[model samples]
Target: MSSLPITLSAMDTEVRVSLCPSCDRSISCTTTVFPAAEDFQPPQDHSSEAHGTDDASPLSRARRAKHQACAIKSEIARLKSLTKELKAHHRSLVELSKQQLALVAPVQQLPVELLHEIFLHACADEEIMLRTIPYTILSAMSFSRVCRTWRNIALNDSRLWTFSTIIDLSALASAYSRPRGSWIGWDEVSTFKRLVSLYLSRSGCRPLGSLNISASYNEPALKAAVDEEPKLLPPSIFKHFHRFRDISLTNSVIKWAELRVRASQESLVKSVKIVGHNEPDMSTVLFSGAAHLTSWSQYVDDFVPVNLPLSQLTRIVTGWISYIPAFTALTQCRALKRLELSLYREFTMEEDLCEPEILELPHLVSFRLCVDNPCILDDILDILDTPCLKKLKLSWAPYSGVDARLTDDFSDWEWPKDEFSRFMDETKCKLESFTLEDLCIPPGVEVELRKQLPQSTRIVVEENSGWSDEEDLDLDDLMSEISKSDSESA
Candidate 1:
């Protein structure tokens, strides 16, 4: 028989149960039925007619949402706290990195002795030092930037006190005094002051070894300094006579009187070089400044007027205008071992008169003469009086009549046979090497010159005025063929 549908008939309570068919186990659940009409009285079975009780109450749903909102708020607070902590940690790390960098940066620590050794190295290889390393080191100011220890070491290092020989003293002073300098301007000034004081205290400027001042583009700053503030630089800067060993100046407008006044105090300046567009009037101050100059290179509008009684002077190199007079003035330099002359725009026929009687350099071991005219060689060979002359280089262009000024025929020119033969005989024992470039000689000349040699002399003859490329192999072939013929004949 089919079970009849049952409905609860209680006033306010109701219950329902379903049974599993196999086990007869009852599964409990609840449901409520509600009145459909709005204006109805309680139904007879009120337990089944409570419609609102079947759905979740608004208060219960609201309670569950409140709990979920609280949970989400807690999660957001936790994330914000974590983010703040991470930021704090990153800031600390950055600060620590900065501290570490400050602590570990490389610093110069060379002592005075070590610095002196370094300076010695620099002095030995002046080209490399001036061209590369010193500029690089000074450019970075690395020594100045390190901690107090390095700064102190660098400041106290006397080698650091030295400046480039080619530098402008005025510019250097200005840079040292500028407000925005790497080191405080006062600090640089103080350092320079201390160095000057130290150098001056010991025998005035005796400790001041070398001074070089130069300016280009016609800047008048240094000259102004010398003139206006002769006292600004330590009188020791000029007054200490006899300590300096070298002096070089170029394109300078300083007066000779001032130079002599300054140099009179320096007893030891031995090497001097003066160069510029216009030569200084050095005649009056020549021997007055220093009598011990061993090496001199200068350019004068006229000949060197003053004779320097330089007994120790061993080398003389000059460019332009007054070489004959300059050589005559160098007669006192009996110890001179080398002579170099660069004839720039020959000024007179007097220059072509290279007479041994007038210019005698008996001790010269090496001689170099650079000129355009080959005819000058005749005069030069006649005047070569040095029995000790070992090397002779003549850079000249033969008269190929290439220039309209030259003649194709030079047969009419007579050789000074007596003077030439005497010079050859005198130089034969000493001349060990000869270099001739852009030169031409009659075929018999070379053989006769070689026969006069006391010992084997190495002669190099470069024929063409222009350099020949490797593809021009005809000369090489001719040399090879000549060598073969010589071997077969031998």
Candidate 2:
């Protein structure tokens, strides 16, 4: 066979060859027309004429076809290697372009001051900071890992590390119940303690934003640690107590005694929340020198005496106190701007009891009252005179015992409409917001209550007793705004 001509085109890049044999006309074929190895078929015969006599026999043709296929496969493999190299080069160029573009990104061009503010905003989520244990430190570390500039900024600016730190020792306590040599591995506990130390050190001289420590009293882990090992919390943490701004200790009674001992030194603490089965003594005056203490909250089973500087407080939330004691406590909180009280059980009405003297709270702007019995609500409202009150929230949960004969359901109970109206008129206060939770008032009564307040006042009433599901006003935000305004005015 002899080759006549070869043709090529841009659209079809494959090389086309024309062949002319001694006894045949011209035939055209492309390089890609060669059959793959699996598709190729060999002659079945092995006679002398097929193999040796004629060069154009089936055996000779098969051998030529096999040789051609081998050569084509070698060429195809070389081309594949070249294609792969080209693709790798293309990817490198793309990555280089992306890096160049990132260098001139708008965020990268922002001034350090603006970037600092943006970072603070990113870490301003208080709920996440409070709920997730050690997340405050983890979040700061994450910001530092972004880039060199971020790392420099995050490490230098102490505000990023000032989020509320919540250390929960309940898990550690549970881990101690195992066999003798197997306490929850010390590596984990050590790592956590190290993180806490690192977090505090990065805060510099700035006041600690908040510190929340919770552990159970029933767990012997804490007491055992105090006796036999180093404390679960690093000793360095207590050294910074004077700089603590907000503090919460729950369940562990020993921590309460520690705070009482350091009360005079905690001059920077602004808020304190305590929750437990029992606390130190009723007569013990904790935080005696905390002049900045403006908020106090306690959750206990019964009414316990407390000797705080109530005259200077701006916020107070008490748990389960009798009406007489609650009223007496309010009379001392003359500077209070916000007050919340939870009264449990029934109040005995004695005929010999004299009329309660009216208590006036001139600076009060917000009040929330939650009672299990509705019978004493009228008497409570009659005695309170809040001239500056702007927000009011009333929650009712009917007691379900044989002695609590007030009412089984809120719908059957009578609302103190006349008493509340008379109180409003007597105080001459303009309420900007009002809320009634867990009280299934009739539609008609709701309309009347709405009419008593200003038309612009925001009113919320949950009739089905599912108030927790609804979005109520955030009192903390309100009080913060008020405090800010007060400071600006001062």
Highest lDDT scorer: 2
The candidate 1 region of ten consecutive residues with least summed lDDT is: 125-134
Compared with the true structure, all predictions reach lDDT values of: 0.51, 0.67
> TM-score for all predictions?
0.54, 0.61
Report the lDDT tens digits of candidate 1 across residue range 292-393. 677877653344535465667798776654345544556576788987775433333354444335346778888888654545555556655677788887
Off by over 4 Å in 2: 1-139, 142-155, 176-185, 216-230, 251-266, 279-284, 345-355, 398-418, 432-461, 464-490
Q: Which stretches of candidate 1 lie over 4 Å from their true place?
A: 1-141, 167-246, 250-264, 277-287, 305-307, 321-327, 342-362, 370-383, 395-411, 414-421, 454-456, 463-490
- Per-residue lDDT tens digits of candidate 2, residues 440-474? 55445666766687876777765434434555433
Taking all chains together, the TM-score of candidate 2 against the true structure is 0.61
